[model samples]
Target: MKLLIVGATGTLGRQIARHALDKGYNVRCLVRNARKASFLKEWGAELVIGNLCKPETLLPALEGMEAIIDAASARATDAIKQVDWEGKVNLIQAAQKTGVNRYIFFSILNAEKHTDVPLMEIKHCTELFLAESGLNYTILRPSGFMQGLISQYAVPILDNQAVWITGASSAIAYMDTQDMAKFAIRALEVPETKNQTYPVVGTKAWTAEEIIQLCEKLSDKTAKISRIPLGLLRFLRGFTHFFQWTYNISERLAFAEVLASGKALTAPMEQVYEIFGLDSKETTTLESYLKEYFSRILKKLKELDYEKSKSKKKKKTPFKSSV
Candidate 1:
């Protein structure tokens, strides 16, 4: 099957492209920078230089493709409207014009319920557009990426920095990007997954306190936990309107409260596995993912320490008595 992967340079999109190639599908990628995407050619992907923000570029990329997987996301608030909303609409139109058979999209879990949030609102609008575009579609609503949590909470603990947990008792599930990519491929291949939506969740759920424990056990590093009340999270989210921020700190804090309330957690979906015939892959645990990442962090720290020690010795040598 010939497949075109939009946003092929992104974290999840690249993985999907690689997995599709590994599965022996002919892969094409819509890319903005041919140089950055040169490596993808080595991985057996045909790179079509184009930006999703420009509709004229999408037609050439969408041509002669059986399916399109949209994993694109905006980096900033303004880009969200242009890229996520407008860009996806452009792709849907191009796909319809080209008679593309299937359209797969990765949207965040609970996006339909969070229309007030800017990012979610964009995704919600895009989902509506895709459904009405007269193309066969499969939508995967994945939980937060496991990497996001590990980078934020696990890395800080490994580096001996304080990580603040808003609700100690809140439990949330996170999926590895690799797993999400694998499932996305299945959705493309499996007949049962067509024209359906699935909540692609992690194998297990962890509470905020349990998250710290897992990291502490795996890295052998103590994590300083600062617990904040839920009320404070609401107060903090109110501050997002004062000025623009990149990390979406306000939405993050607000979502933290949702995780704490257990509202965002995905319940077990036996039907998803049964219908898709998804085999049990290796479990993705925080301890397992952080082990190697912590080693790298420790290695970098040691390198910096060594450099500082060498500089100190050079200084202590007294400059050869100013000779």
Candidate 2:
């Protein structure tokens, strides 16, 4: 099948593109940068240069395509509206005009149910638009990304000896981006997935404290975990907003509410395994992933230290004073 992947340069989008190619689908990547497209070309994907803001540019790339997977946009409210809502609307129009059969979208879990959050609201709105667009559509609402945990949680603990978190007790199902990509690819290939919304998540759920404990066990270091209250997090959100960082206050508040409720994960791993044909039983525990992550980080830090030492020695000339 011929497939066009929007946001193909992003972390998740790239994975989905690669997996689609591996599955023997003809893949076209819609990318904003030619340089980014160069790498994707090396990965065996045809590149189409276009921005999500300009829907007209998408038509040529999307023409005669069997499916379009939208993984673009930031997680913020404004970015979501611009890219997820507007851009997706444009893509739907183009797809209909170009005779595309299926439209698959990557969305966040609980977006429809959680109306109080700005990000979720944007997602909900986009889903509504897709429903009324008269196109065959599948919406995949994936849980928190495991890759995000590595970047947002584990790296901090490894580098700073602590995991500072906004919502401490929130139990979120985290999915490996690779797994999510595989699921998306499978959904695209299967006709049963059309006109459906699937909640995709990892094999298990983990709280912030539990995650930190697991990381500590893996790294064999007692790292501190600092928890910020909802109000304090709200303040920090304001500070981040002042710098124009792409975070929404309402979303943060919604996250706080989720934590306060102490709810378990709603997505089932068995469904993921059944769909993707992987033994989803093999868990990516927080401990195992963090151990591997920190090992590489420590190696890089050591390399940097060696480089710094060598530079210092080189700077110490014969005339230079030895302290």
Q: Against the true structure, whose lDDT is highest?
A: 1
lDDT of 1 by residue, 1-323 (tens): 99999888877888899999999999999998999988789999999999878999989888899999888887535356678888888889999999999999998787887776767777778888888888999999876778787666877887688888776454667777888898888888788888888888887777777778877876778999887887777777787656676336665555555665646466575777777677645646556666777778778889999999999887755356754
Show how many residue pairs clash in every candidate, following the order shown.
Answer: 0, 0
lDDT of 1 at 225: 82
Clash pairs, model 1 backbone: none
User: Cα deviation in Å at residue 268, candidate 1?
Assistant: 2.1
Those runs of model 2 whose alpha carbons end farther than 4 Å from true positions after fitting are 75-78, 234-261, 282-285, 298-323
TM-score versus the correct structure, for each prediction: 0.84, 0.83
Q: What tens-digit string does per-residue lDDT give for candidate 2 at 211-256?
A: 8788777666676777667677656555655654545554555555
In candidate 1, which residue ranges exceed 4 Å CA deviation?
A: 76-78, 227-229, 242-262, 281-283, 291-323
